[model samples]
Target: MEYSKKTRSSPRTLDLNHIENTLSIILSQVEEPLPTITEIAEQLKINRRVLSRHFPVLCHKIVTKRRHYMRMSHLAAIEQCCQEIKEAIVSLQQSGEYPSESRVCELISNPGYFRYQQVRLLYKQELQSTLSSL
Candidate 1:
């Protein structure tokens, strides 16, 4: 009696050029946030180590893009918060009330906006401007 051995097929090879093109496309999109290397690797059905080893530049770009996006998002939020605080101050003054921190917190969507130094500085500046104008 002769026994036959079953052979295992090798994993499919990845197209490095195709992966680079796909990564470029993913990075080029303005609306979507950049994904982490792990996330991208998972989406591509490849191991993160393999992806990083094959495309170090793309991995770096993704990290850089994510950081930039986060910074811009944070700035936008601070801008919105400052605008809300300004509006709230005006509204309070119009209604014959002082714009205290608690009052401003009550007026804005995020009560914790005051926790940020930028937001606090803006609040103080606006308050001073209002007082000086009086």
Candidate 2:
């Protein structure tokens, strides 16, 4: 005469078209940082494994796109840091001052750029050029 009251939760429904559209929108962005597949799945409130299973190709594309974007962004940052170092050295030379590492670090927009090996090499080359020309 007693009845159980337990109810099972229903599985989530996914709209494949909506997921594709959302992914399209994200991929269309030129400047925004690309999200990883896990991030996309989290944003869509789906489990990562489920999303990967449902959209394996899209997931792969997202990973590739993110990789390319990250590489380009890093290259751009390196170029910018090199340019900043070059400008700082030139300014110091024009002002009749030696471009010491400390002085260059103070003049550049980001002193942290010195951590980059590429920037450091460019700085050394530019310094050598300046010294040779004097």
Candidate 3:
């Protein structure tokens, strides 16, 4: 009779807490310029597939929510910039100086200054309509 040896393979164990902590660190580090998932995974010394497996919902939700929050923050910043432009125009008017496009562009220093101008116009229109209805 001949005896055969059977080999068993051990299953890979995942540390969920470690994964969550790594994810938290990645999310917190994302600021003005956001890093791609691949970049983040590479930074963590892991592959995207492994990351997605451990944090499926988090993989999508955290990035989506962070992007949404960043957009909201950008909008708020534009609104604040528009308000400052309005104040600057008022100040220029008081000083008997005409507020020109070149002057505004130079003062604002934002390439999206025109968009903020539109926001300011819309805000004024809304305020006027509300006041008229009162």
Cα lDDT of model 1 by residue, 20-134, tens digit: 8878887787864788888888888889998789888888888899989998988999899999999999999999899999999999998787889999999999999998999
lDDT of 2 at 8: 81
RMSD of each: 4.5, 3.8, 9.0
* Reference-based lDDT, each prediction: 0.89, 0.87, 0.67
The number of the candidate with the highest lDDT is 1
lDDT per residue for candidate 3 within 1-134, as digits (tens), equals 97768667675676779878877766666554456567767877778888888788777866686678788888887877777666655565566666555555566656365655675574465445544654
Residues forming the 10-long window of minimal summed lDDT in candidate 1: 25-34
lDDT of 2: 0.87
TM-score of each: 0.81, 0.80, 0.59
Candidate 3: which stretches are off by over 4 Å? 1-17, 24-36, 120-134
Better of 1 and 3 by TM-score: 1
Clashes of each: 0, 0, 0
How well does candidate 1 score on lDDT at residue 100?
Answer: 96
For candidate 3, the 10 contiguous residues with the lowest summed lDDT are 122-131
Q: Which ten contiguous residues of candidate 2 have the minimum total lDDT?
A: 24-33
Q: Report residue 9 deviation for candidate 3 (angstroms).
A: 17
